[model samples]
Target: TATGWAQGGIAAAIGADDAPSLHAADTEAAGAGLTDPAVALRVAAEGPRLIDWLVSLGAPFDRDADGALALGLEAAHGRRRIVRAGGDSTGGRVLETLVRAVFATPSIEVVTASVHDLLQDENGAAAGVVCERDGARFRIRARAVVLATGGVGALYASTTNPRGATGRGLALAARAGAVMRDLEFVQFHPTAIAVGADPMPLATEALRGEGARLVDETGAAVMAGIAGGDLAPRDVVARGIFQALARGRTVYLDTRGALGASMPTRFPTVAGLCATAGIDPARQAIPVRPAAHYHMGGIRVDGTCASSVPGLYANGEVASTGLHGANRLASNSLLEALAFSGFIADAFDAMPPAAVLPEIRTARASSDLPAIRAIMERHVGVVRDAAGLQIAVDGLSRLAETGCDAALTALMMAQAALGRCESRGGHWRSDHPHAAPARHTEATLRSPGAAPSEPARTDEALAR
Candidate 1:
């Protein structure tokens, strides 16, 4: 669902002068030294192949006059290698293509339900899942389980992600003993349309790539004194706008000088979002602010996309594959997912089945999500200090102890943020005010379930 809502195009190295090495270099630079060089190179190389595969599956990409793929540009990239479809609606098109492929595949069956617990063997290897549908629980047996549930943006009071993006998969994984990494680095997009919407609508960075500018109330550039100006990597741009707002200034994204009347045709999705917000981009500046957009950290996965626990794997925003380190390069999330999916499939095919199996029914804990969101937005947000992080850690940890899934996930993020004392990439600490030696923050659930729980009717089979 997050993939379908994504508006930025995919990044690739298919231009005449472009190379995978160059694209990898750009990605490493943006990641601030935490990105794995080998991972970056390999993922970048797979970009063109994945795009071609999508096309073969009937994805209609925008093309130039000569019939080649029309590549656009985004910030922090040295070349124009962003591949889009239906203008700024690349994600929706890609999702539609994948859905058609899945529907035609007789081997794959789709089930809609809320997965709450992991079924593991006596040896502690993942075996299957326990799902709840219509208030009744069922156990689905499988050799392996892979999670692609997406990021934790909805944990923030203001975000561009759907409400369900609350990191439920993360809670499930953490409880199952998955090692999490870099939980501190959450990317905040600098231009989420501020129209008092519950989940804010995003104004894609591609608009700035196409010549839009960030300006304040008096028409003065908001990012004038910032390096890279309006086109900085997401973190820098977000901090720039955040500091301006902290100083009592209103920030806006002005597209009048750029796309103007052509916006409807060039960026149909954003134009429609603007129309809903009662904004006319051709005549008025779009009111904007930084809001949670992506998570650069997640369940740590190996090169094969397998987690620390056997028989369990992750993909998409739920897995941290070392491709996105401190900060993710623009338009790389979708490409990374496409590339790693192949590795996940290969890993599962070669994995030995667990000899023992068991069933576990879990009753999820409820929490005051509003209170948790307020704590995160007030403390662990765009900028942080030791005191604020401490407050966040204490507050979330309390709720986490009660087995509240949302609070447990938020607690993991807060604990990571609190441990890192330096400012780097997306985790900017106003107190530290400078970058330190780059390192990752990792976490694992120390107790059984963050809290104890009782199920209505429990049935479990244990295997050796």
Candidate 2:
């Protein structure tokens, strides 16, 4: 589910003690200097109303006894204004409510299947998706297709996303001639529990907000600016953890002094992980390391969540709405998804139904999936340089050389990542670590055997 691993609560300027401008400023700061100020301002301004709407929909946000909203502070926030539900289980709770609403509505159909490839009509516009369900292949045709398939955290050996977040939507859009952006900005959380889990449990930023400290094996503060440490933006914190690992220092998060008596009630998710790892948070420091968490870049979309392809829509982590910019603020992923889902739904509802979608069956067969996974994890995983990115591009191109449509998606990701020369947000590179003055570029070329040309990266093209 899209909401299972969300540990931090939603960031909003809903608290009386806070204002929207402060929130927007923090957002731009976290986005690594590439955040669109207009988008930041708009989302921040509308956050309170969105939160109220979610509350009305039975989101169960924690509220004070007097009926005021109970807010919690996370990293990068200038105030204690995060809206939470069931403590750290905000994502799960929100997902539960949304799933129920989706199931109850006759307008939405919940299908349990993985989309194998996109189906296109004679005119070359995306018409439907080829999905594999219950070991049988089928096609679901719609006038508009919205991809909320989530992120690529699973491609790494360690992640905090669902197993399906293998950049499936990213590849799908690229192969369909949709414009992609910011493919290089992959965010790595600095405080993932290093328990060797495939998707490591997250040590939420709330722990630091509650006064947790990052220390080494000797219980010494390894990070500078101790008082203002953990609240540093994700990039600084992730790089700090990387440095500690480079020096062979065992990194640990000291929550005993901060979480205190509220461990079980306030953050059940973190408590459960600690119990499973056999580490008592009240008594000992938890082992921690940085791991891939979210993708800042994705299939490019406009305000309406439509992609470059007509009738194709993308939402959630799959769509790059220019909101997160280079880096995403903590807990904003869920908010962005919720806000845009409506944008996509509304746009799709207003469009007419497709008269006759393509019925041509795909001839491609699945093979070497494991090899493709290995290649992505090896070169395109985390740190990247020009040579490594080029190698990844070549490798993905060869995958397309096999004539599999799925491989084209991977090739597009590699090609886009290779073209981005500067580091921004999650897209860090030793070769290009500084932001350069450059106009935004969209990767609109499709995978092999598809369309070709330099499609414009305009809002109109994204809305299709």
Candidate 3:
């Protein structure tokens, strides 16, 4: 995971949809089809088999009353494919199992350090990573480098991701001259716990699946005019919550009547979080707000998880395989990690070894992370406009004088969001409120400030 932890996610995996859950209209709205639907379905179909594999490795799961794996909360796409464990603590539980297995394995050697950059060979292929550990900087030389450095949620002031998710992988890849696609599409979770916490606690959408509703300070339905009410798509709900907060009306997830009795058992994690915040979900509503939760855009990769840069591979949230498009479907992240991890392993085994190169050391760039994060939250957040994006661009450019990779990654996202004038899926623009012709935005490190090279047809980028 990006946080250098055993776990790689928020850990809810989606199963196959029994029917055609995705549609053309919704896809158009989501800027979907960057990844083929058939590919997503194929990976999703392997969910049961993957679950069985994990079970054999000692991971536990929670089943429904019918003895079937309990499907998690339905998403905006109208499907209930999420399968979880330890109730709301599924990610932690899953990570624990993986950690134990890894430690038990004799071949694996764990390194505790922060990676500074990707080392490249004479032919411009990834060779290894430069890292800092125990107050000393060192380089580890290898034939290939795989970056799984997580997402950029920490770039925002209010986010559910750990602080280390500063888009380091994206920065490393970009610095290595790798192509990145769709850096603009960041997904904001609709109901993060609103306590004044740094890494805010998430109020899982499953609460709504269990019957909770969103309400305003006056106890009026927040999603009253929306079609799906509280069960609406994440972007919709997030926008609504953002507008509600803008209106000075505090929003909340009213679980008092919905999951009151079952709170402690079904959602022990959430219950404990609420208790810590001095609110009992069994009797009172849980205060909530929208938060930076996931990034849909990342380092561009092909079907086999190979990046544009030879010998470079990315997996987990760091790689953009075009699977999620402008917005990610819930619980698909873990599924992608499992599938691509296997694919990359197979690919790695088949490759002929590259000659070992000598280790090279370089100075690391220092950044004012707090200032950069503030600029992002203010300009390139849930809703954006040209002027704000320009301000972000200029601010990031100034920060980039330090050669900070984090600032560079933030600049790329702001540039992409600014160049994309139309509002589509997660890249909502207050200035450009309507969708234009659908296109995939691509960029490289060479020209960060240039407009997107002429838009390409949808067929040009979709996953096989």
Clashing residue pairs in candidate 2, if any?
185-427
Task: Report model 1's TM-score to 2 decimal places.
Answer: 0.96
Compose the digit string of candidate 3's lDDT tens values, residues 259-320. Answer: 86687788877888888898988788889998898898999998778998888999989998
Candidate 1 lDDT over residue span 1-464, tens digit each: 38998898999999999999999999999999899999999999999999899999999999999999999989999899999998999999999999999999999999999888888887777888888899988888788989999999999999999998989888888778788889899999999999999899999999999999999999999989777888889999999999999999999999985486788999999999999988999999999999999999999999988998888899989899999899999999999999999988877778777557764644677888999999999999999999999898778867765567888788888878878899998999999988888887777766433223522111110000
- TM-score per candidate: 0.96, 0.90, 0.90
Question: Residue 303 of candidate 1: its Cα lDDT?
Answer: 96
Tell me the lDDT of candidate 2: 0.75
- Candidate 2 regions exceeding 4 Å error are 225-228, 258-261, 361-378, 403-411, 446-464
Top candidate when judged by TM-score against the true structure: 1
The candidate that wins on lDDT is 1
**Candidate 1 Cα errors over 4 Å, as ranges:** 448-464
As a TM-score, model 2 comes out at: 0.90
